[model samples]
Target: MNVDQIILQSVIAHRLDTIAQEMGAALERSSRSPIFAEACDFACGVCDHKGELVSQLNGIPILAAAGSFSVQAVLEKYTGNIQEGDVFIVNDPYRGGNHLPDIGIITPVFHQGELVFFTVSRAHHGDIGGSVAGSYNTRATEIFQEGIRIPPIKLAVKNSIIDEVLDLITYNTRNPQMLKSDLYAQIGANKIGQDRLRTLLDKYGLKKVKESIIQLLQQAEDLTKAEISKFPAGSYTGEEWLDDDGFQETPVKIKAEVTYEVNQVTIDFTGSDKQVTGFVNSSLVTTKSAAYIALLWTLSPEIPRNSGAFRPIKIIAPPGTVVNPAESAPVTLSTLHCASEIISAIFKACAKAVPEKIPAGFGRYCGPSFYGIDPRNQKFYVGFAFCCLGSGGGKKEQDGFPYMAPISNYGGVRAPNNEANEVQYPLLTLNHHLEVDTAGAGEYRGAPGIKYQVQFYGPDPSIVMFGDGMKIAPYGLGGGKEGSLNRNQLFTKESGNEWLKSKTAPRSLQPGDILTLFSSGGGGWGNPFKRNPQLVYEDYKNGYISRESALKEYGVVLTTKGIDWNETKKYRGIDYESRYNV
Candidate 1:
């Protein structure tokens, strides 16, 4: 390529990024759900006519990566050729992406009446019609119960809305008004991206813009391969367990076998448990999107993530397994539950290959927990409330971020205020704070857990809590102790009532019933004995750990002002086991 070609490619790439940002801003401004506007639980990307990702917003990582496939699925399934002003929408987990709640819309851009590019936007609506209020039932046995599935259909064609499709969606969902408004917001975002892409194509010519996408993809592929080659040429295997499959009381396993050869790496999920009769089953596209993100984080954190970064990596998951279930399998909580285990296994594989480069495992999975119900007004009000929890940190790094949403990191940034929650639903969020001493102890302590309380104002009979990770805690790295397990409890103003049975049972709540959620903390990294005394003292002073627990778990002696290093070492070195053989 000549100098002019390089310059033109760079300019086009920058313009596409700008287009993505504009689409994202429009979505945020127009969305009715706080998760989209405040939490930014959405993604916007520009794609070539072939449905390859060109650029994306810096919003939710997993959403941005997985949403690309939704657009491509539409392009492949549509019978008629895509023309200018053509728009398509789909949310079928079996056909394309994660679940039915995340609706995606694709618009084909035109330059001089020629189809030049496409723009796609996806957002998680508040509710999709299902057996459960939140559309995600922890104990759901089949996909039919999850939500309404919509295949590729023209939401808007030539700027004219499709009334039939809109009517079908509205009829199926409990919140038709909110869904309709959010659907238009998604369409509006895609339109903004389409306009921006057309403007860029007109200035640079379609040939140059297309050439830039190819160049951009090639650059990402090269950088990714270079990073993979740096690791040792070998295969590594790791496994993690969910507390139970919501049906059986025993633990179920998910395993990963990662092979790093030449410039490419493949993750094979064999020996994983058969797909459970629950929402734990993850779709193949969702699995690959997660693995790709973890590999990028481990190998090339700075490289732009588009279609290019994944050209060198392959993901293999046998059908019927947990990672790649059949089309009928349910996957509403893939982001919260199964996806975390997949990422944890991949990161563990990378840590084994490059220990210094990787930190120990932070508690990867949390917040498939759903808590809420439908008020008498027929207005669907629900909450995926336990999303705020810390992850276990690696040795070199502090415990993973506290109350941070795993895989996506969408929950941590400024949360929706209590007033917003009250305004939207008939529920009151009384408390949302960090759980004390939830982080496991080590040289580098894990992040603390989160605690939240929700009280229902109106009569809503069914409220489910899909909390997992009870029996098997989030494991630690480098000989560190595993983090604490999660806890869920029910309290009421009335004198006595037996607690609901297990993680799967839906709580039948009265108007004044109060629910408390204690999210688990991440595990520590390295030996606690080696943790700096000053840091230990700081932890106690900062209210992260109690003084007594620190002395017992970390063997640090607390003085009036801070830790006494010499005294701490003397007590830490003492073998209490020798004195008391109990």
Candidate 2:
């Protein structure tokens, strides 16, 4: 291509990306729920008339990829009926959706009376008519018990809202006002994207704009292929285990074998365990989304994300497996823990090919769901709190960030603020802080986890805990120590304190009762003795590690006069390497 054409294509690509970003901004600003506005658990993107992703905003990568599948479903079902000013919504897991709560809205745009493109928005509703208030039923054995499942249906037609369809959705949710407002926000964002795309079409004309999009997609494909070709062709395998399926004591295994060939990479879950009778089974959509997230992280950031970029990557998980469960399997909790395990397995497999590029294991969701009637207002409240805790594994030169979302969602979901929690619900925060000696010991130490206690202030509330890494701690690499295990407890005024089951069924919490959670830390990298002593002293002075742990774990000696250089040398000894086989 000539320089002028190349410049034009770049401009068009930037415009498309800008439109997606604006859609996300609209959703965040207009949504009513803290999960969407504060936690930012939403995604926006644009696709061609053929339902191929062209550009996407920065949010949850897993949710962003859902747009293509959702759009394709709508187009196929409503082939000749699609018209301007029409919007369709879908959240059926069997119909190209992650789960029931993550509803997606698709709106098509036409240029000069011809179908051209589509704009899509997706967000997680806090509650969607489930047996449990929080829509995370740990004991649910089927999808029907999880929540309402909406197939692809028209939400608006000819620029007019469909009151019947809207009412049906709102009536099924616990918080109708919040759900209605969020749905409108999603629709409003798509309208904004529609207008922007039309403006671009007007400026560049249909033919030229279409040509630019084709060229842009090709550029992304070429860039991604070049990056994939850099890895040496080989087969690598990784395995991970879940504590339980919330129904049995036996652990469930997830095994992944990644094969890299010339300019292509394929991940197969053929050896994964069979589907379980719990809510942890993952659907095909969630499995593919998790694999996409893993590959996206491995590729260079310069490569533009579009359908073309994924053409060279393949994911396979046989039907009835935990990773690709049957349609009847409950999958409400799939994306939370199972998705993280999938990503962890992929990273473990890739470590053999590119050790420096992968970090150690990070903790997944280890939080509580509280739902009850507030005596003060006589109103019901449901809260899902996935609070901050430990850091991820250390990188080649830097330590993983602590208290961030797991690799699956990354920074898209934020932990609720302590002050906000007290004001929004009938609860009181007793204590919240970082736990010391919880980080995995290595050359670069893993991030430490958190400890927090909450007490019920009003009537008794129902509480359910969801997470993993309780029995098996986050794994460490290169001889690093494993991170601490997750712990949960109940402190009742009548019965004293007792350990609560990791994946506990919902139960009542009397007033004045306290719940405590200790989230797991991230895995560490390399050997602990190789860590810098000065950094160890800093960790000691900052109270992240005790002097006793320092002495035993890193062979460091400390006194009132600070670090004892001679004593430290003697503690480490000259033959430390040979003694420990470091």
Candidate 3:
């Protein structure tokens, strides 16, 4: 290729990326729910006519890849019926979707009466009608109880809205107004993407545009392969476990064996447990998306996230397993819990090959859904809060960030503002602060978890807690200590505070009842004795760790005269058995 062609390819690639970003901005500006507008739990992508991802804007990593699968499903279902000004929507896990709440909207772009490209948007709806109020039925045993599942269907045909289809979807969800508004926002974003792509096509001509896309994809593939070749060829095994399947008291396992050979990687989940009776199962699309996210994080940050970037990666999770459950299995909580475990397992395997690139374990998942009726307005409200307790262990150079969401949803699901949340629901947030001494102990301590309290203001509110990392805290690596466990409790005026289970059964909270949540902390990395004493003193001064904990956990003695170097050295040298007298 000549210099002009190379320059043209770079310009076209930048244009495609800009189009994806514009779609995201449009969705954020038009969405009604705070989860979409404030939290930004949505993804926008531009694909080729063949449904292969070309460029995807920043959002949830899992949802970004899931959009490609959803577009492929639509293409397969509506082969020749696809035309200009037609839009299709899908949110069926059985049909290439991540879950029921993550709705996907796809639009086709035509130039000169020929299909040239496709634009897609996928967003998580706050509530879809289900057995539970927030659509996250932790106790659900079957997929039917999760929520309404919609297959690939044309939401708009020839620039005409399908009122019947729209009505059916909105009527089923608890928040009808928000649902309707968000759906339209998705449609508007798709239209914007379609127009932008068409303009580029017209300016560069079809042949030139198509050639540029091919060149971009090839460049991404080459870059990814070169990065993969840096890792030594070998197989590494790693395993992770959920607290339970929300049914039994026993732990559920998710195992993976990752193989790297000749610039290619394969992850096999042959030893993972079978599908459980609870709603923790993950669909095939979700499994693939989770694996892709882990692989993407492990590789160099410079690689472009296109279909070609995933060409050299393979994931094998047999059907009927927790990672790849059957159609009948419940999966409402898969993306939150199961997908997190999968990512952790892959990270553990990669650590064996590239320890410097992988940090210690982080908080797995935390989702607390609250719903009740407002006596003042005589209306029902469902509040879905995706809170993060803490981040993973520190890297070689820096400590991890606090209250970070799971790897798959980084920067996408933000904590809702306190004032906005109170105004939207019939509840009051008493406190949302970091818990002291909850971080794992190491040379560079992990981030501390958060502690929050909420009280009901109106009628009895039903609370459903879907979380993990209770019985077993986040694991540590390189001789670091494990993080603290999660705790959920309720304190009522009539009844004193009582501990609640991780996967608590739906129960109503009386007026003036307060619910307290202590999110789990991240695991630590490296040996604690190697930590700097000045940093430990700074942590104590900042109130992150109590004085007693600093002495016991870090062996740092503080007094009115400052550091007691002799006592500190003695404490640090004492073995665990000798110090504790076990």
Candidate lDDT (C-alpha), each: 0.74, 0.85, 0.85
Clashes of each: 8, 1, 0
C-alpha TM-score for every candidate: 0.92, 0.96, 0.95
Ranked by TM-score, the better of candidates 1 and 3 is 3
Where model 1 places Cα greater than 4 Å from the true spot, the runs are 1-4, 363-380, 390-392, 408-414, 494-502, 572-582
Winner by lDDT between candidate 3 and candidate 1: 3
Superior by lDDT: candidate 1 or candidate 2:
2
- Displacement of residue 184 (Cα, Å) in model 3 is 0.4
Ranking by TM-score: 2, 3, 1
Candidate 3 lDDT (Cα, 0 to 1): 0.85
Error of 2 at 20 (Å): 1.9
lDDT of 1 at 204: 78
Q: lDDT by residue for model 2 over 261-347, one digit each (tens)?
A: 878889999999999998888888888888877876776788887888878889889999999988878998777768888888898
lDDT of 1 by residue, 410-493 (tens): 242235666776666677888888777878887777777777777777774456666466666667777666777777667776
